[model samples]
Target: MDLAFTPEQQEFRAEVRSWMEAHVPKAPLKTLEGREGFDEHVAWERELASGNWGMVTWPEAYGGRGLDLIRWLIFEEEYWRAGAPLRANQNGIFLLGPTIMEYGTDEQKAKFLTPMAKGELIWAQAWSEPNAGSDMAAIRSRAVRDGDDYVISGQKTWSSRAAFADWCFGLFRTDPDSKRHKGLSFILLPLDAPGVTIRPIRQLHGETGFAEIFFDEVRVPVANRIAGEGEGWSVAMATAGFERGLMLRSPARFQAVAQRLVALYRQHADTASPDTRAAVLQAWMDAEAYALNTYHVASQVIAGAHIGAEASLNKIFWSELDRSAHRAAMSLLGATAELRTLPGGKGGGEENAWLEGYIFSLSGPIYAGSNEIQRNIIAERLLGLPR
Candidate 1:
């Protein structure tokens, strides 16, 4: 409960800050399709990998700095403050890497972990389908065992990073007759397999960062299964817990964005009403609260305590705050904001980063278990409420 960082922790923060100031790109990361900006983001990730700061808390064997979780938080703060590229393979490295560390075989670790840590092998999450999204237990994608391989056939929509990823980790119904949560299995498949097809989905913001994937008898090696058949629901749930919680709701990233939003507001205060000033002040307070919550969670994680539903609360707060802050920014920019995409770019700012962020924020309330479901978890499991 002591909130202060130790002397060693403070020193670690200074070290990370110094490293990032030297390496972070001079300009903001470019959205994909931008000439040098996209490449620059990739280069920034590689630069972090080169510094052994890619996955701060992973074991050294997996290409990490071998630091503890507190130090990892410091690294994240510094990375965001320096305006480093967003972790493009976060679905692979943040959510799946930890799952594999706990559940995967040594061979699986040797194959996926190092490459993921080094940013050499980017991955996508192929979980949502035309029918099964928030209700992951309803997944109908099937993978039937065929000697040394499994033939997978189904469609996955909202498959982020599939347009550029080399692999995907997802759930499949290996026991179709077993019903609901009992029939599923977790599996990894190469995206370039002959029978696999990927088509990009253009967002409201004009970005094609997400896609739909079709598996037409796509064959994957039996070695790709993460957990045993019938254990996929638990594996997927566990993964979602991380996705919607501490790892995905990194306070440092949110705080940096919130800071930028504040700066953007100040740059155009003439357009903001007194009510808008109140909204911005509230947002700043919420951002600070989120930072404090994350720091507490980091301390608990570093002390080897298991994170629980409280992480869900953190996700809920930060995601909504992100939306609120961005909306405020767009509102302040007024008519000029309509000039989106850096003046020469097409569409409004709403269609660029803020719009994309707002759309993505909408998904936050739905994914990793909907906010209503998260409330159920908090009420029943955390608060001991009646079913």
Candidate 2:
């Protein structure tokens, strides 16, 4: 299997590299490793949009470069290489943008896609409720149609970024009597609507990226519905597919982490034992494997392949790998890793990064569909196991 790019692809890589070097911020915006509170992160996203780097895979008409998936991969590689800020609107650009392009109406596309690509609109997701997490079909949020609007009433917990978001996209039960996965509708809602409440959940890293959102008779126009009533499961599944696949966890992200791990290893080499050295080497190798697989996925996507259950494998790999890499970093940091906050009068060193990374990595297996669920998918769908 040839893992090389063509001349055109190589040129695209250089172009993206040059653009990233030119436009990537000179200073770190925020250290959002595990913590949240990044208003500047949104500003950085718009900066990328200004540089035409916000959503390179999106169409040119929608303010993107209209690049192929491979080019998008190249862009991601360069972005990470520059140690640039991660896009604050990843949920919108990575998952919802593509789903809307495929299943949204022309009006929906005209309304959401362009601003999304331009980083003008920020979106949050309300998929996982208190009672329903990995089991999305268990969502009880009701959107009763009343004339021209749907009066939504439910509580959404563990909502990522809703506290600072402009809009929200989620699944709602349009039919009270319909069974699981049926009678659901995908709807877009404004966060500022009356009766919509957002309460932040502070993480171990002292950030409020996660939140609990309550909707009390919040009214959303029927025009904001993505797929028609009773078609939400399909729309949601499509979005989830993208979530597990290359769209969310790009291979370039793993590569960037690997480089960081290498630098961390060098920083504390005197303290590293032979066993720790071996572990670091293994992580480097695993990160490379993830990169190669990402390229394979990018090539398949460029060839117009509709990503499938195999994307679950990547999701499981990266999430677990991230967990392991951060764990190793903590181990390597030893006693110094306990301090999570920045040094005030009492000084903390590089270990704070490891502690924050470790805490952040703990969430990986739980979010984006649990690792257990992904394993089940691999067994039932990929391995032909009985449900």
Candidate 3:
């Protein structure tokens, strides 16, 4: 693989770096999990749209710059380097946006993608159910056909961004008799629709970024369904691939954390143990390795190779790397890692960010299919192990 960028790629990176430096918030915004923080981030999304940088890989017709995955990686690198706020519409731009592009009708794309890019609508994932856990094939939520609409009745738990987002997309059992991964349909619905109830779940960190959605005979138009009935398993597998592979968690995200971790170690280096220093170096190297591997994956994707069970490998490595890097940061902070409040009890930015990240990192091994589950996939599919 060619590790060197061409002059044009370098120029594009410079353009992105300049724009991000000029427009990124000088002071960090609040966490996008809170209502105020979520609003602040939505506004940032609109600002990005103004510059036509919302989703650079998307076609220009859909509020994007008509770029490719390589350009998207560059954009993410500069974005984190600029210390930009976390995206409030990640569900829209990353996971659902690509799925919509593949399975949605042109009318659906026209109605959804542009507003999604413009930040007119934010999205949540409604895939996980209380009983189903990580096994999405075990989904039991029902969407029964009724004339021109489908009546949804069930519960979805651990819905990211559903606490304040505008819309959601997930799988539902369209045929009541259908079992496992079969007879499901991918459906979209507004959070404020009638008979819809959202109960926010506060995490251990005291943030209500997730919610449980209860749908009681909620009627949504038939047009909200993506792909054909009973084909949701296939569509959702594609979405899962995105979530597990390159799209959802970019390498630059971890690279930025590694940069911060290095600085953090230096700050407390005098008293730091040699082990901590070694761990820090390992984390940094892991971040760089992830970046190079991602570039390789992007090249293959551009050449028409689809991510498969191999995505499970990517999921395990990055998630564990995230936790390891943040663990090193927490070690550097020691007891003060918990000192998020300033003199007046106001939250501090840099100090607070590390603690917050460490807390968030703890969940990495669990979400987007748990590392344990990913291991099973690797064993059965990749390693040809007997299940």
Candidate 4:
């Protein structure tokens, strides 16, 4: 396949780059994990939405540009290149929005999609329970039908963005007697609903990036359910593919990080060790590989092909590359890397950002299905090995 961009695609890239250059915040916005930071990120999301950049891949009726996958990738590249704020509503836009488009009713889409694109409803993923992390089939959360509503009761831990999110999408056991992945329902819940509690879990960097959510007879309308009962496993698997394969961890992010790594290496080349320099080069190469792979996959998607176990391979590749790149950055920073504060009062600069990224990178191997489970998927499904 030809890797070169067509003239039209190149023009599209230029448009994205120019827009981001003009609109990206002059100073980095606060981290989205803190209370104040979450609000700031939300405002930034609104800013992006105002420019119709919030969900370029969504249909125009849903407040998007109705762009194709290739343009979407270009937008992401410019987004990261601009060093824009982290997406405060990524759970809604990346994972849930596409799933809704696929499985939700027209009413559901009309109600959720527009607000989601406008950053009016930030979403969290409540997929993991205390007993269910990698093995999501072990989730014990129950959603019992009560007339026109379902009363949900259970706990979900490690829920990203739950601390300040307005909504959550998750799977629950709808059929009491069914086992494993069967009889499950994908459902959406308002975080402000009665009997719902969110407790923020501080991360290594002392930020509430994840939370534990408890539901005690939380009443949700049947209309909130995404697909039919017992079909959640399939819907959720598709969402997971988006999470692991493309949307959640885009290649543009790594390319930007890799570029920053190279700059950092150049700044310290005289003092840097040979191994660190080599690692920096490797990071750049890995980032380029990921970008190429993503473009190839995007081409296939455009051709109406399904992405399956290959999502697992994508996840493992990017997650490890992220960890390695951050490690090299930390190594290069040496003693200053550990400092959360610089001499000035500034909370986040290049040094602190890398430190924060390193902490967050530690979770890449765990969330969106653990690397262990992903490796198992590669071995059993992709390689056709025995389970």
What are the per-model numbers of colliding residue pairs? Answer: 0, 0, 0, 0
lDDT of 1 at 227: 77
Error of 3 at 155 (Å): 0.3
1 or 3: which has the higher TM-score?
Answer: 3
lDDT of 2: 0.84
The whole-model lDDT of each prediction reads 0.80, 0.84, 0.91, 0.92
Candidate 2 on 1-387: residue-level lDDT in tens?
Answer: 676788998998888788878877776655532333256778788888888777988888887888888788888888899877767889999999998999899999999998898778888899988888888889999999999999999989887888788999999999999888999999999899999999988876777777899999999999999878999999998898899888898877877887898899999999998888887887788888998888888778777787788988988999888888887787788886787555562332223656766887888888888989999999999999999
What TM-score goes with each of the models? 0.92, 0.94, 0.97, 0.98
User: What are the clashing pairs of model 1?
Assistant: none
Order of models, best lDDT first:
4, 3, 2, 1
In model 3, the worst 10-residue window by lDDT is 342-351
Better model by lDDT: candidate 1 vs candidate 3: 3
Give every collision pair in model 2.
none
Query: Looking at candidate 4, what is the lDDT of residue 144?
Result: 99
Query: In model 4, where is the ten-residue run with the lowest total lDDT?
Result: 342-351
> Higher-lDDT candidate among 2 and 3?
3
What clash count does candidate 1 reach?
0
Clash pairs, model 4 backbone = none
Q: Which stretches of candidate 2 lie over 4 Å from their true place?
A: 31-37, 341-351
